[model samples]
Target: MYLTFITMIMTLVGTASSASFSAPNKDLMTCTIAVGWMGVALGALSFVALLQLRVYGYINTFIWNRKPTGVYFIAPIIYIISMSILYAILSFVLPLNGGFVYNNITNTCVAQNVIYYIGLTFMIIQTVVLCLLLFKARTIDSCFWEFRKMLLVASVGILFGIIVLAIQHVHFGDDKVAVKGILVIIFTLLPQQVYFYTILGPPVYHLLRHREYYLHEFAAIVEEKGLAHIYELAGGCPLGEISDLSDSGKPYRTTAVNRLSNDSNFSGNEPAPEIGAPLPRNSNPRQSGPLLSYYKSLWNRASRNN
Candidate 1:
């Protein structure tokens, strides 16, 4: 979300300046450099996201053994801040036309210096790293499969955008309309498409069309992998309930209890398991976080509906 917001701001500033101001305009030059710096920042953030995903996959498989430290989170913040500053400094300090290239056809100032390509090259390296990481994590289970798919598509988009920018600089310099259109596609449409197809589209389709099956699969995976504690990191489920389910090694199901209580054959004299009751004799100790309570609520709703 931060990346998205920053990207939009950079894009708006650059686009507005480009459209409204002419060459040698101070605001235009400033926006151009800002755009370059933000682009590098975006690449840095993208790499961080990939690293986080890999870490999450590791956590899922061996969370207790390889739990992340504060450094894991703090380090990325430091890297991004430092890199953004370094990129901005280089853009201004370099002697190549103040790091701004003039477009004769569009009468606009843009950044196409060696420093800009250095940032672009950094993005290329990040893409290569993404491919290597994806290859390494190819055998990971379904927990990360969707994210891997998203990264694959994102890698392709990044590469395509880089190629388009390179081509625009070298060959299509005179075609203003084509240049602007490609920029819009690269900066805006490509990301929207990748995110929709990889993240948004699949989940929504599953929820709308295969909700029961989706929930069942989620329950099965959570149960089998002892991943109830993972949701504790996401701040929805209660640690006590998660620990109960994890310790018992059972997916929480209220169906049987609901059925027994609702059955006409059941008499009030007999004891019935209460809905949402925590299991007994749970002894798992690492239970201090917000977590898997959403699934519990989900189960509660499912039970009441039935």
Candidate 2:
């Protein structure tokens, strides 16, 4: 999300620079040049994000124990920033497109082809690597479907962008408007689809349809802890700690119940029942199962006897 916001801001700055190109201000032109390189930097950062996702997928899919830490996480951002600064400096010192040129008709700064190709290479290589990683990562738990979908959309979008770039380079090279329009369309749709499929769509659906799922799951964990405490007081072994749901290598819905049944080390045919316990089972019939139904039956019998 932070990356998304920063990229959007850079894009807006680049757009504004082109929009106001008629002005004779050197400051704006300088801003244009800087933002152009920033665009390349942003692309590199985006690829870094993709690589991070691919690594996460590997960890989850293979259940790798030792994960990346400290320097592994921070180094990429630093590298991209340093590279962008280096590129900016070199643009001045070297004959990279002889520095940026402002095209009057397009109202945009034409950045160095060398820089453009470097950025394009970054996108292509990362996209291909991510797609290969996805074949394995797709087997990762479905709880991460949103992230997987986000990665998939990003890869597809980058692939499409490459195609667009090829077409623009071959046929529309002389037509600035055609090139700009094609780019605008690709960029616009790519972000919007990513936002919908990953960020907005799933959460909104959960809100509307399964509104109580999160609260219910949290309550179940609390109840499980309370039950464990009670069992400990009753001279029995305390229930094992609830595993972190995020770390669970199972489907979201069954994780808690499965953890309770398997990890609690209960030896009996029945669950540990506390006197005057709050109902922890979900009230929704569809979500209820044999264990929850038994709890409900116990509650009902207790209510009548009371």
Candidate 3:
């Protein structure tokens, strides 16, 4: 549940950041929106399942022969097809009344039923898949340990939450207001708290520490494409400023073509100059920064060794 919520929030953040920082191509925008909608659907379904579990003491699961194939396999196929059609209809309808009609549509009986059924299906499928993955994770290769740890942490947190809810159901008997309040706090709030510390916190800190790397890479791409103007248009500092602060250095220019043409010592098909050829004397002054100098030195050393 917490994983789905985090996924949805991250998707929204990624989409918004992409739009703000650059002009996404049509295909990129389409893919981004598709991922965002899928996350939203999953998050919504998880929330609904929690509520149903709270009310009914059990979640409806579609099992056959004590296996979860129906939950893990058939449900996802149905969800993808249904959501594709549903989103197509929504895209056509959403703009018809400046979005006011969305309120009415959401309030309708058909909409409520669809939400209920789809949410139930999604929750069951996700829960079953998560358990299966956790069971299989122990035997997976060591290369997957990082991912396995994350899954294990989240799965344990969610399982703990389920157990707490069940205990409350057995002890409190649904009639006491005080017990109801306790149930809400334990079931709704505790799991999110657990997830934050165990699953979400470390990556967020790592991203904050290394954010400059992402900015540097973006600036390098912009410089390569001669799209510095686009960065300015997006309300970012000019590429020169970013390059100075991030020390990304100028993109490399090949003197190979010029050297090949001019050097009388070289034949037409002498295998291209080794990759670590020294920069021309006329190379950009800005490329004299530490980042480029280090790379150049490393390359020259490798070429000499070869």
lDDT of 2: 0.46
Best by TM-score: 1
Compose the digit string of candidate 2's lDDT tens values, residues 1-306: 345556655545554453334456544347436445554444443434434454443443234322334664456446445645665564455453645566666655565676556545655665565566566555433333434665666666666666657644553344556455546545534653564355545545554554345424433443533332221222111111112232222243233343344433322355634433433454453345333444344445655765
What's the lDDT for residue 77 in model 2? 45
Task: Give stretches of model 2 more than 4 Å off.
Answer: 15-34, 43-62, 65-67, 74-93, 96-99, 144-148, 170-179, 182-196, 208-210, 213-306
Per-prediction TM-score: 0.60, 0.57, 0.32
Q: After superposing candidate 1, which stretches have Cα over 4 Å from the reference?
A: 1-28, 42-65, 96-98, 101-105, 173-184, 187-189, 205-213, 224-226, 229-306
What lDDT score is found at residue 130 in candidate 1?
54
Query: Candidate 2, TM-score vs. the true structure?
Result: 0.57
What C-alpha root-mean-square deviation, in Å, does candidate 3 show against the real structure? 18.3
Question: What tens digits encode model 1's per-residue C-alpha lDDT throughout 212-257?
Answer: 4455455445434444334333222221111111212223222222
Per-residue lDDT of 95-201 in model 3, one digit per residue for the tens? 32221111221221112334334433555565665555444434422211323444654565567556644643464432453454444344444444554454445
* Per-residue lDDT of 115 in model 2: 52
What are the lDDT scores of the predictions, listed in order?
0.46, 0.46, 0.35
Instruction: Evaluate residue 267 in candidate 1 and report its C-alpha lDDT on the 0 to 100 scale.
Output: 28
